[model samples]
Target: MTASPRTPSAAPKTDTTDATDTTEPAAGTGRKPPRRRKRAALLTMAAVVVAAGTSLAVTRPWNTDHDAVQSGPRDTTTKVERTSLSSGMKISGRLSYDAPTDVIAQGQGMITWLPAPGDTINAGGKLYETDGESVVMFTGGRPLWRELAAGVSNGPDVKQLERNLVVLGYAKGLGLTVDEKFTAATATAVKRWQKATGLTQTGRVPLGRVVMLPQRTVRVQEVPGKLGSAAAVNTVVKVSGTALVAIVQPGEDQLSQFGPGRQVTIRLNGGAEIPGKVRSMTPGSGGNGGDEGIQDKPTVTITLADQDAARTAGQSSVTVTLIGTTVDDALVVPVTALLALDGGGYGVEVVTDGTTRLVRVELGLIANAKVQVTGDIREGDTVVIPE
Candidate 1:
């Protein structure tokens, strides 16, 4: 009990030591730096997340689902014939016929000129009568006996007979040009021509004799007069030929569309449709309705493809057509199936085995709802139209 208390005998010396309570505000020099740093980091992370979300909303980057909104295999077409041929390929081509000869002039004083130069009789055209109208030239139709004697001394009958020789495919023996002068050369060519033509004359061009020429002239004029009345030694009458042609004009826009070697068909003014080809044309097509404010119309010449004596006899006028290029055995399809891709190209959706896949395709030579395509895709594959 109190035994331990006896040790405190001397009153503790009260040493007065000034002691300040060192209770400082937890070393205030050290600030709460870490807590603020952690808060700042948290805030920065949140801001970053927001920015990322906004960027995603604006950009709306690539997405498979969004890629969605998008998108006559009639080959074996023939140009000319609808029915398939056994072997020959069909082509659109024009038909050209030979131009006919014409003879002109009748009851002439002196046969001034002739159309064709050859002496092939009845070559088909008009003939000018050798009535020696002009002293320099002479030519004409076959002369009858009654007029023969009268023409020999009165007109250029002999000269006319000689020139007729030249037109009959006979060579001018005396080198006489068709200037209409009576010459021995004319006699030789005429006689040869007469012999070839089965005429009764000897191998000599005689006065009052008329010979025929092959081929005719497009135009002619007949002179009225009595036989042997021509001023020149001998003169005769009877020239034969006619004039007929049709001119057709195409639209100005159709100029390029028309070309050489193009097939054409026409329905004559009063006849059936006749096939033909482009014979010739004016430099260019005119304006609207084919009128360039000019008196004459710009026209194209068309030669009949086929000839019919009866058909041509009727009053004739015609229409013309110009052909265009075409292809055969071309693999084609409905133009609608061609879908434009987003990347400035073309594509097609192919359906194979119940699955559809889009494939890029290259197109070539598009015409009339049909287009040529080349790619890994083969023909006969079903195509899915893009919705």
Candidate 2:
């Protein structure tokens, strides 16, 4: 007999039965589906889904296609080279005496006589007269702060006294050990020093009895103490080096570019260029000791490598050129060739054998319209630049 076609209403019950057959039983029931799906069928479904997605993405059938826009030859180009690059700034300076150093009084007495401003005081010589007595300078590694007499504490002050006595010819037969401790021989040497300096011959060396300096001699700049004034721990005189120096007041940022012994070119106001080196630097308010921040540049003292040239140049305003930054044997290109990359940072467009590529580079100092670069670039490589 022929079977009658199933009515549409039977479809719902058939679908429900098929769904129940496919679904697994609830948890803890331990009941599995009536029929297991074929492993090949599940794998095939997953692969087909992935393939369909990939095809849609690759084809993008709904979108319209346009002609590719080709990049033409650059309007300008440059060759990368290995060379030294540096950034520099021209700084104004002047040939002037360094700041006056205060000759502070070390002892207490009446100021009897002062040295003339133009006088020069040598080491181991008298600095000034106090109450008709000389406050003499003696060679000492340390400054004398207390009485160098017997029963005094052992310190460098006592050693300085003993050394001074030996040099001054007081310890002839005493055989004093120039150590940091006081001995009877040291006291005897002090007595001899007191007698020579026209004192009461007390076997005690008092503080402020002498002034010590690192140099051999100093040119007297000024004598501020007046005759008959009480000699205390005040600045008695002002002095400076006899040699001329170029003073450069560079701002804080530029100071980093300079250091002791760095070479420099000094252009005097009278139109002369001299080779010099940075001798020293003092960080503070350059003038008047005001509250001017970095604007008040530190005073940099530059000494001419040639002493005769410095003397000839004389004291005047000058311009100094200092080396600020330097990179040697570096890959470099024109500043214009540096390009802002689409992702970030910087890059250059390199043209090699008619083929063009973008190369990222690390940038360094920019000097004289050229920039230092490093990276996938090589020397003699042609790079594209804007006109």
Candidate 3:
């Protein structure tokens, strides 16, 4: 037999109850709750929803609303000011003497004496002893290739010898003219120089009697021959200019960025920094075999402004920083003040009075944790940063 569908009955009505009420209806009681209690419960829930929305509005991060003003301490702020900014490129280098040249022995004699490394030799100074005779130092561009005597052909080497004699005060009364000719007066001057230098007065300059270099003073860098060794036609001593210079090999693409007289900074191994300038640049020997795609590197020489300070480091590796393009009298700010906007580009928060607003800026040279900024930003304006 099929069952008949029962009719649904309406729910019992009662007055509204307060949401805070914890009382329950008595067992077997037919009485319904008042409608006021139900209304009160809904009103309480609505109040809670409104309270949560108010909290979110007050605690939002980085409020963009222009009408709102920030309050409390102002420690997270910085000022924009006019300053100079430049980019730098650091290269590894070594501190050492300049123009290292080999002093080769040109005579067939036994080495009697050799100067210790680091010894300074000036014009008219004894470089080393050969067969009980001293080989002197002379300032000239070319070495003495042939024996200089009264019968030798005129050449620049003879003039170099005559000039050295005049500088050493040996040609004061000889009336010797400094020319490419080895005249009789030059022989007399040579004799006087030989007598004063404790050598035989033969009035003739033999090959290997003097070591001609371009500098007025030279520092001995190495002594390759021993005291008792034969002074063969080989490098007896290595010498260099007295001044110290930093040598660096940078890529060929950076050749135009460096030149003579450009200012630079040198950081020594001891963490001390000193000022320097570019002294010279030499093009590198390019080849096709080595690194296929890489170009040859050029050599750069830097001279320190403070020679006394540089001497303290001796021979050691250092860092050479080359200053690149510079922006002078530019509006600058700390790098931390920059903010990346959701839309493309960058901006900084400008704090005026107690309010903050984003000001778009165009970036320039970034150096030393500071950046150059432009576009509507003025010097002395305060900018905000995150703490």
Local distance difference test scores for all models: 0.39, 0.64, 0.73
Q: Estimate the TM-score for candidate 3.
A: 0.67
TM per prediction? 0.37, 0.57, 0.67
When sorted by TM-score, best at the front, the candidate numbers are 3, 2, 1
Write candidate 3's Cα lDDT for 279-334 as tens digits.
88987767543878765677899998878888998889999887666778989887
C-alpha RMSD values across all candidates: 31.2, 22.0, 20.7
lDDT at residue 166 of model 3 (Cα atoms): 95
Better of 2 and 3 by lDDT: 3
lDDT of 1 by residue, 1-387 (tens): 000101101122232222222223345644211110001111232233232221111111111111111121221222111211111111222222223422222333545433332323243222333433121123345432333322235344454554555665687446756644545555566556555544554554343333343324322223333333442443233233342333455545444444555566565555466666655677643344445575444556555654563135443444443333344554544444555444223445555544444444544444433445555456576654322
Candidate closer to the true structure by TM-score (higher is better), 2 or 3: 3
Ranking by lDDT: 3, 2, 1
Q: Give one digit per residue, the lDDT tens place, for model 2 in 187-246.
A: 888888778777778887777776666555677878998899887888888877677788
Error of 3 at 214 (Å): 0.5
Could you say which candidate leads in lDDT? Answer: 3
Q: Number of clashing pairs, model 2?
A: 2
